[model samples]
Structures are given as C-alpha cells and as structure tokens.
Target: MSRKKRIAIIGTAGIPARYGGFETLAEQLVRQLGDKYAITVYCPGPKYTKEERKTSFQSARLKYLPLQANGLQSIPYDSLSILHALFSADVLLVLGVAGAWLLPFVKLFTRKKIIVSIDGIEWKRAKWNRLAKCYLWWAEKMAVKYSHADISDNESIQDYTAVRYTSLSHIIEYGADHTVQVTPTAKDKEEYPFLHKPYAFKVCRIEPENNIHLVLEAFATMPGYTLVMIGNWKNSEYGSSLYLQYSGYNNIILMDPVYDQRKLDVIRGNAYLYVHGHSAGGTNPSLVEAMYLGLPVLAFDVSYNRTTTEGKACYFKTAADIAAIIGNTRLAVLRENGFRMKEIAHRRYTWEVVARKYDELVQRVLNNKGKIPVTPSVATIPAEQLISYELAHLQAPTPFYEKR
Candidate 1:
C-alpha cells in the first residue's frame, strides 16, 4: 500500500468559509480531496473562535495562527504557514499572492511542491493603495515565477499571465454547485419584504472597482425598476456614503451583508435579474453562483465577465446602459439568457470538475511531468494573421485589420 500524499492549504481566512472566493475554494477543495490527501489547513485566529478552532475540520488538520488572514498581516500569516508546512507537507497549495515573497526561498531550500493560485490580478483592484498594489504586483511575479504550478480562475486571467509572464496557468474556476436555487418561504418573505417584488439583485463588497455607484445610479434614474443590493455598507466611507445616498430611494433597497447561505440564496434566486458590477477579478464566485441559481446576469462589459459567462449574458458599460437594458429587455429574452447562463454554469462551474482539475495538476507536479514549457513573451505573428487563420467564424476581418 502506498502512503497518501501530505498537502498543506494556506492563505485562506479559515474553514467553513464565511466570506470571499479563495476561502470558499479552500473549503470545497478540502471537502472533496480530504480522503485522498492528508491535508492540513492553516486558519487565521482572528476569523475563527477558540471554540470553533478544533484540532481538525472534516478529515483535515487545522493549524491556527494568531493573525488576520487578509491585509498586511497576511504576509506574516502565510509565510509562517508555509514555513510550518515545509517540515511536514509534500505540497503547499497556496491560494493568493500575500506571502509570495517567501516562494523563491521555499523552492530553493525545500523539496516541497508549490502550487499557487494568483487570485485575479490583485494589483489592479481599486481598493489597494499604490504601495500595496506595487507589492502585490511584485508578489504576483514571484509566485508565478517560482511555483511548480500556477492557477488562473478565468481564461482572461490565463491570457494575461500568458502574455505578461509567458506562463501556462491552469484555468480552474470556482464552483457554483454550493449555491442552491431557493424558494422564499413565508418567513423569508416576512423578513425580506422585497422578496415579493420583481427586483434586480447584487451582492458584493462595496468597492470602487465593483461599480456599485454605477449600479445605484442606474436604479436611481429609473424609479420603476427595483434593485436589491447587499454588501458591507459601513465597511468604508465610500460604502457608507453610498448607503446613505441610496437607502432613501424607494426602489433601491441597500441592505448590509447577509452571510447566511440560505437567506442570501433565497433573495438572489428569487430576483428577476442579477446585476454584476464588478470590473476587476477573474471569474467572480458571486457571478457564477447567480448563474447556478438560474438567474439572468447583467454583467459589466469587461473581458473577465465576458470570459466567465462565455459571452452568453447581457453586458453594460455605464449607468445608462444598465438602465436601458432593464427598461427595454423583454422578460422572454431574460428567461432565455438565464437558461443559457445556467447551462454554461452546469457544464463548467461545478466543484467535482474543479477538484478533478486540481487533482490532476497536483499529480502532474508531483510526478515532475507535464511541466509548462518556457515560451517567449512576444508573439511572432501579427494579430491579423492569427485571427484570420484561427477564427473561422469571422466572416469579415477583425476590426483591428478591417482598416488595413
């Protein structure tokens, strides 16, 4: 009998993911792969209580650290977790670029396999200051350069890495199977009166990059259309001001973050349409979850969102675009969009598929086979030639070559 491989999952807040994408990914990976691998997960003490911090979760061991898993402290937290795992684990499955500065040393000194997921292009996020963004940018380079395998959650991110780092990043998007299509109970309707009405729903961090202001402005302009947006309204001054400004609107219901899974699902699943304002990040978990709930998405017009939805959903670039779509789009079109979105979600965004990809990548890394070849950063051929030859569906030349 062969011994099971030892794996360490680092960079998440904790198990029983209370928030965010990486945490949820970590949780799902553990649940699916626990039996096959001897997994040890690092939990940040700030996020989990002493009572909640048992020695183990599911079949995996939990190691608690006395620091926050996010922000500046995550650097130390992830570094310490990596150092501790170096002694015991065969593979270090790191979820973010927070402690990527230590990866070069880990790769140089230890035999442990380092697999990293650069959680979207973190440096591009509007929340981070210039200094923080610089550090993140550097860390991202280090993580990609040093890791045995790198992951990108969306094809757009993969394209970015392929062009920037000349690295072949495994595309493993977040699973949406965890999200259920919930019917509002009488109690649910009593608790959330907005459940009874036809409204567009959105739930995300109230950040500048997410375009919360744009969504609010769009809904505000059209009094007939209702918008139910849930987020951490008091987390920042921007969020606070937005809440104050929009909460008074009869059509726009600005609610605080709702962590309860079923409660959130019921509200989201019952919506007439799901509006995704996020302009950053790759394959947002919330967006995919909405697709799983059979909701038509009105996503921000961006390559990342387009890639995630496979260009099947509606898109908006501005407040007016969103407002016009809501006002003009027929219910039948919305239903068709929802069905197509659901089909895409069912085929691509399931945990079983995601876990299988991870498992394959891990095995390939451990075996020292299927290593990504070093490719030149620059393309040899012009964009016009490549598109003309590769894209058979394009009847006319691409807009870039149309003028030529």
Candidate 2:
C-alpha cells in the first residue's frame, strides 16, 4: 500500500487527554485518524532537565520541548515543532496562530502541506495588549493566507475570514465525542462537594467574552436550581467579586478549574441544564459537549451560538432573557430542546466525520489540489444577508411590560 499520510499536530498543551479544546481536538484526530496517518505530537518538557527523553505517544510520535505550550513561550515552542515536523510529516496541521511568525520560513523552504485552524478570532480577545494584538492579527492573516488549506470552527469565523482574507475557509467545529456519561466516584465528592447536588453546569475562562457575570446574576435570583461554574475565578477582580458575592449563597457554587476528566464529566454530563453564556469564540467545545450529552442548552443568542445550535436550541441575550428561559421554558420543553441539540451533535459534530474531513483535506493539500472540489465563483452571501436570518427572529422589548 502507499505510505499513510505522515501528519504533525501542533498548538496544544500536548495530550494524554485533558479538557481543553485544542487537546480534545488533537485527541480526536489521533483517535479517528491514527490508522490512516503517521502522527507526531509536540509536548512540553522540563527546560532544566537538560537531557534526552523518549519521544512518541501511543501509535504516534511525541517531540517535547522546554517551554510552556501556552502564553509567550508558545511562539518558539510551536515554531520549533513545525521546523522539526517538516522532516517526517507529509502535512503540517497546526492548530493555533501562536507560531505563525515562522510559517513564512516553512513555506519558503518546504513542499509540506500546511493546514491550519485559526482558533477563533484570537486577536480580538481582551487578553492581548495592543502590540500582541497587532502581532496576532498579522499572524492570523499569515496563517490563513500561507496555509495550503485553512479551517474556521464557526460560520461567523468563516464569514470573518472570507470577508477579510477574501478566501473560502473550511468550517470544521469541535467535536463533543470526547465527553462520556461518567458517574461521580466516591473520591469525586471528596474533591468537589457539589458533585452530589443537582446543579447547572458551566465551564469557561472568566472573561468578558464569556459573560460569566450575567450567568451568575441570573442564577443568584433562582433559589431552586443550583449553579456550578468552573473557571480561573481568582484571576481577576471581576471574578473575585462575583465569587465573594455569590459564595454565601447555598445554591451557587463557584469552583476553580477541574482538570480531571472523570471527576469533571460526571458533574458536567449530569447537569440539569448546561448554561452557555459565552458571547465569544466559535462553536465552543464545552457547549457542544453539553449538546452531545443531551443537556438542555440556553446560550447567548448571537449568530455564533445560533449557528452552532443550528438555530434550534433556546437562547438568551440578557439577564431577563435568561430568567425568562429558566422560569418559563418548562422542564419537558427543556428536555425536548436537549434532545434536539443532541440530534444535531450526533448528526453533524462527530469525531469520525471531523477526522475524515481533516484526512481528506490533508490529502487534497498534499497533492496540491489548489482548492476543494467546489466551484470557485459561487454567489457568496453578503454580511447583511447573513445577519438578517437571525434578526428576523429577534424578539423585541414588550410594550406591555413598560414601567409607565
């Protein structure tokens, strides 16, 4: 048989399976594409060890470098990974835009197929400073432009890329198959006291984009339902104050990050309703996982979310919307919505399909197939046309509820 596609995966904190989206994406790629691709994954190693270490993972190669996989060091670490991967891998399937500064060099020298997924709109995030944002924006442009093929995880993202870069992008979202219906163990309850309770589930970075405060405020009023949100709550004054404000409330549990899969999935999968208040990011991995497990979704009613949920799941834009959703949307209706979300997940967001897409793209790019087998001159939807779909359904302020 012809040689299997030698593939390199970069831009994750390496994986023996943790919970982050990049890691989960890598894991799925390995799971579904292992037999078809000779894979190499770059991992973080100790800088001071100053020594040799075994390189490889189960059925795939591992190359460990002496730098953190995220933050500033990610630049050189992923850059180095790509440099090394050029040798053994037929395709470079980079995940993020962190190491994109070096992408030009790779393009200059190698015939290796380049496929990149610009993970959300990284430059628009609040975490980056002005210079960082500028660097990231350029990096994002380079990643999309230089790559033999590019991926966008959400339709909104695709729209952004197509509008900005004037290039068609592959829309490949995060798969939720990594999540299992795990039961909380005895040790889980010891670790997390809230594991025993009936609670709503939320896991995300505590940032303005996620709308954490909105979720907290809405949940604070509801006494019957318990809310358990996980994030780096101590990282900011906003997070700290919200935690302090809601800590005394017996119904709300503001927990820190839970890295263990079995421990976290139990609470996540068994949640009464998965409260997804994320106002940013493309098809969020956590939200999709909740959908995959058939948890009732009440997401922020943005195009990104409405598109992710296929415009079928319930949504909320504000505190009142959230309150009305929880109060008015009956349990049976919630269950039906949960089923609807799950049906969408199983039909559209499966690892098998994702892996197949990646595999096909890698092959197509490797053969230099210029582009996918779609007509180049199709009628593209305008921005206003895209937004009009949701605007038509947007609920307006009720005049009957006016204070006058």
Best by TM-score, which number?
1
TM-score of 2: 0.87
Q: Which ten residues in a row have the lowest lDDT in candidate 1?
A: 395-404
Write candidate 1's Cα lDDT for 1-404 as tens digits: 49899999999989888898888888898899998999999999977766877888889898999999989999999999999999989999999999999999988988899999999899988778999999999999999999999999998888788778766888999899999888888999999998888999999998999999999999999999899999998999999999888899999998888989989999999998999999989999999999988899999999999999999999999999999999999999999999999999999999999999999989988997644643532244566776778843443333221223
lDDT of 2: 0.82
Candidate 2 clashes between residue pairs 3 or more apart in a chain or in different chains = 56-62
- The TM-score between candidate 1 and the true structure equals 0.92
- Estimate, for each residue in 129-193, the C-alpha lDDT of model 2 and write its tens digit: 99989989999989987888999999888777866776778888878887788877888788778
Candidate 2: stretches off by over 4 Å: 47-54, 183-197, 372-404
Top candidate when judged by lDDT against the true structure: 1
